[model samples]
Target: MGQEINQTQFNEQAFKEYNRRLLNEAELLQTQLTKRCFSDIGEICGYELEFWLIDHNYFPSPINQAFLTRLNNPLVVPELSCFNAELNGVPLPLRGDVLTAISKELSQNWLQCQEAAHGMDSVLMMIGILPTVRQKDLCLSNMSDLKRYRALNEQVVTQRVGRPLRIRIQGRENLDINHPDVMMEAAATSFQIHLQSAQRDAVRYFNASIIAAGPLLAAAGNSPFLFDTDLWDETRVPLFEQSVEIVDEANLENHRVSFGQGYARESLFECFAHNIATHPVLLPMLMDTSPQQFEHLRLHNGTIWRWIRPLIGFDHDGTPHLRIEQRVLPSGPTIVDMMANATLYFGLVRFLAGLDDAPESRLSFDQARNNFYAAAREGLRAQMVWWNDSVTDAKTLFMEEILPMARQGLKDLKIDKADIDHYLGVIEMRVQSGQTGAVWQRAYREKHQADNLQLVAAYLEKQRSGAPVYEWEI
Candidate 1:
């Protein structure tokens, strides 16, 4: 979705031609993978953090055009809504002091973004969903002024046969609403992490990410309230899945934005094959690139929003590489918290990938998918089924099993002990204290009778203090 398209208008002939080329590229990619023609890159880490733009009164502010123009930084880009923007980080090798280095870069970039937002009389906020954002604030008018976004809205609505998108979420409170455009997706923001891996290890890492989603999300759950209705601890899960809901005509049960049908059996290329076979082309723009570039394949993959997406990229020398993008974590209670989440994820994934037997072999894909939604709905309190078919609460699983594995994984990666201790320690305290961003927000709302704006104000205040979420007072 980050890539831009030249033409938005599409006729039947154009769509057919584009789809043909897309499949051709997919075939070429498959052949290349079979021949092991991709770059053998080591572990590389990066992230894209999404944030909301709000006014002084803590209301959704649709001023990103001016705000971005004033900011004028290449790393910053517009999101689905004008009230949202994303910051991308430089990919770095995951070793030694990499965590600290990335944290410094993110903090500095955030400070610069803050300065630019202030220049436009708006403030930047890092949250999964802004508590003050109302239904009125999510209209099409608030969508960012981008042709790709406009085209996406048109394509999704057309796929739905012009029916209004229906969203029904049941939690402590129920929310059922109808939306006209994809703007409902703009309501949620996230901190997405990426890890580049060799083709041989990509599938294992991707599956490991799926299994890790439950405990990781429980430890980092944010976005607990949407439109003043108390919902899932990580409401963004269902919110995003349903916001642009599309069902496959061939398979009515299959959804475009989903937790995938099953695990990758052989290689990550199986995912691309599944994508080519199952999903219809959402963006059919033809690019003037060779089959080796896989432009069409990349664009088609972008439209399918997998929680753990498989990505193909190129190195500095134009050698193609594969990456696993972890899309589960929410944006921020603090930058350190975001880093902590990334640390725990990288460590756990590395540990899981290095196991003698694949974790997915022991745990069914159904169980992994169910555990994810359970954690999203229940946070740390969620009970998850792990290896050996044992069920346990997320907190106990993290403390007794996952955390130690993460520590060993970091040590195996040769990360500095201080860096590992500092970041993983944040996760340790968060689990022990049972205080994540979602917990703090719920606590604040309970005390203040769910005053959304005041809650946002308090959140921003604590956010600016540069304290990890566990240290913040509710």
Candidate 2:
């Protein structure tokens, strides 16, 4: 989806050519894996954080084409909406001082982005959902000027036979609405964490990531309001799911954006095989690249928006590697807060995947999927069935069990002691005080009886303070 397409419309011949290349690439990947041909890149980490561009009044600003040009940073680019932009971190090895190095680099890049936004009398805000966004702001006119995005919108609507997209979210309040295009997906942004695992442990690491989703999201929930109506702690989950739903005659998968069916039993190859077998081609952009590049297979894989996605990438030497992309966390309350979320994720998953026994064996997949939705809806207040099959509140489970495992995981990774203490301390305080971004937003609205404008005004002020969400005053 990052790459631009040459044409928006495709013919039957285009689909046939694309599928032919996809099959050849899938077979080549299988042969390479059977021969153990992939190079082992020990645990490496990266991030893709999405942010909103708001004007002086804190409303959405549609100027990213100009904003990105003025900014002129390759690492930062336009997102689905002109009001949104994404920042990508350079891949770093997960070892001593890596966490601190990530923090310093992010701070530096963010300073440059802020300067560019300031020049245009606009600023950037990183949150799951901006509370002040109106329904009018999500039209096709606001979409970024990219052919791939335009083609994606056309393909999704075509799959639905021209019926308008329906979105019905049930939270503290019921949100039943209809949208004309796929731009409603632009309303929800995320802080996606990526880890390039060793080829031998890819399956275990991928399953461990699925099992860790509930605890991590419960602690990092930041999106509680949409269009001034109170919704789930992270309303982005359902909003993104229903925004671009494709109704196919053969329902191989229920929805494109979901928690997945089951854990990986043999290998991650099954995921790519399933992608080839189940999904119809959305973007049939037949490429003229060699089979080794896997261009057609990759472009097809990009269209499926699984919550935890498997990515295929090449290293500096052109060796293919398997990466686990965790897409469940929201963008932010602060840069440190976002990095702290990364810390917990890397550490806990390392511990879980490296265990002598499999954690997924003790916990069923059904409970894992159920726990995810429960955490999203209730935040720290939700009760989850943990590894021991005990249904406990997410807050207590974190403080007593999950946090300690994460601390041990970081120590095992050989991270600096200072980095562990500072980052984990932020998360510890957050869980202990019960003040995730969602919790703070709900408290502010209840106490002041304020409108959405006032809420956003106060949020921007505190966001500028560089204080963690747990430290914000209601």
RMSD, each candidate, Å? 1.3, 1.3
Give the per-residue Cα lDDT of candidate 2 at 318: 95
How far does residue 94 in candidate 1 sit from its true spot (Å)? 0.4
Q: Please give, for residues 1-474, the per-residue lDDT of candidate 2 as tens digits.
A: 276788899988989989988999999988887777776897999999899999999899999999999989899988999999999999999999999999999889888998999999999888899999998999999999888899999999988889988888889988988898999999999999999998898988899999999999999998888877788999999899888788642453757777887899877878888888778889999888889888888888888888899888889999999999999999889998998999999999999988989999988888888889999999999999987798999999998888999999899899998999999999999999999999998899899997877888888888888999999999
Give lDDT: candidate 2, residue 273. Answer: 87
Model 1: CA > 4 A from native: 248-253
Q: List the residue pairs that clash in candidate 1.
A: none
Stretches of candidate 2 exceeding 4 Å from the true structure: 248-252
Report residue 146 deviation for candidate 2 (angstroms).
Answer: 0.6
Scanning candidate 2 in windows of ten residues, the lowest lDDT window is 247-256
| lDDT tens readout by residue for model 1, 1-474 | 298987777889878998899889888888888899998887999999999999999998899888889889889999999899999999999999999899999999999999998887889899998999999999888988888888889999998899988888999899999999989999899999999998888888889999888888989999999999999999999999999887633553457788888888777888888888878888888889888899989988999999999999999999999998899999998999999999999999999999999999999999999999998999899999999899999999989998999999898888889989999999999999999999999998898875998899999999999899999887
Worst 10 residues of 1 by lDDT: 246-255
